[model samples]
Target: MPTPGFPPGTLDSEGDPIWLTELASDDPNHTLHVVQGLEPAEALEALGAKPRLFRPCVLPEVKPDEWTSLPRAALALDSGDSAALLAGRIGAWTFVYDDAGHTLPHDDTILLSADGRTAASSLYTINADASLSYAVNGEQLAHLNVDDLDLDEELPGLPAELRAAFEAAGVFEIEDEDLEPGEADYAICMRVVCALAGLTGTLDDLRRIPLTVTPFG
Candidate 1:
């Protein structure tokens, strides 16, 4: 039998999900990231003695379901000098990586954009089938090959184009054992973002249109 998977909900001490790679170092280099549930004062404290403060701006909306979007309130903290310390201390948890290169676990919605003209949000949440639902930009685009997605339920309304894209992105797997949703969903979302946004999924691309990541408490 394929090696047993890490117990469900398992995470490293840093709060990084078991499936995600940790940052090589805590040094900041303008990479996109998110810190869940830090108050302004606490965030400021995390920033250090001095941190460039941008006027508070509402964070991007996270659609937990098709009809509801959670509007997160946040203060924009400029990198000023470096965001490493700020990133490390601002929250109980942090979901960050190089670029659109992350699979947010638990209930995190990270917003990404290419040129501000178009955007996509990768949402990872548990589905009714006990499998993870990885929806892009809150759009419920399903694949016709339900087996590839490990979908136990039917999705009569799945769009053909999305199915085609998933195939093109090599989302289908022939594993002998069950696989965690992160195994395919993260890479699939990366490819889908490229297909729909017309931009290579990279840190530079996101820098051009920085993410407005809002964390829920």
Candidate 2:
């Protein structure tokens, strides 16, 4: 069975998620920290004194007639200094094992170019059926394999309703253009995934984690 901590496949027990309060430490590479659960208000309170950032971590649950197979939660973290932080925000959750020179939980993995120019076509599948495919670009990317719908051969702009849905589901943002394709793909996929999960909204309502720093005093 999947554990209740972190994500389904990442931990063995329900421990408070770790928060990095300092950038430098006695052992920067090996340092460990713990964060106890806080209510949304309390979390905001903690952020008042420190440069803390928040991301939603979803608890896993089974859903009936759902197209996606995996259960997931959002993970909010500091987005300023570390590649790991940026990667987490973009939906790539696996950790790199330097010793192994590889990443874990290899399923549905997508790799992005450093400058965000290029992205792999199938880093992750949507709707569980893998019927649709996607390619990323600056304004909007292609959503292919849409066998379920047949409006026209031409790529249609995201409908107002779908756009609204994306926003309402906490997946939309104006800063998306500045993000790399991989990061953009992560955001787009999350919005679509939430839609498939029966959540409502347009992309505009999607909440994004702000880039910030934290200091321990």
Top lDDT model: 1
Tens-place lDDT digits, model 1, residues 1-217: 1111222233333222222212122221212223335433333333232334423223233323332221111222222312222122122323232221123322222222111211222322223111222234433333122235542233334355434333444432334536563345333443432333232233222333322232221
Worst lDDT window (10 residues) for model 2?
A: 93-102
lDDT of 2 by residue, 1-217 (tens): 2111123221112111112101111112211111122222232233232225433333223322222111111221232222121111223211110111112111111222122322222112223222222222222244433234332322246544334433333322234245332222223333333332232222121123222222222
User: Which pairs in model 1 have colliding backbones?
Assistant: none
Candidate 2 all-Cα RMSD: 19.4
TM per model? Answer: 0.29, 0.20
Summed over model 1, clashes come to 0
Against the unseen true structure, what C-alpha lDDT does each candidate score? Answer: 0.29, 0.24
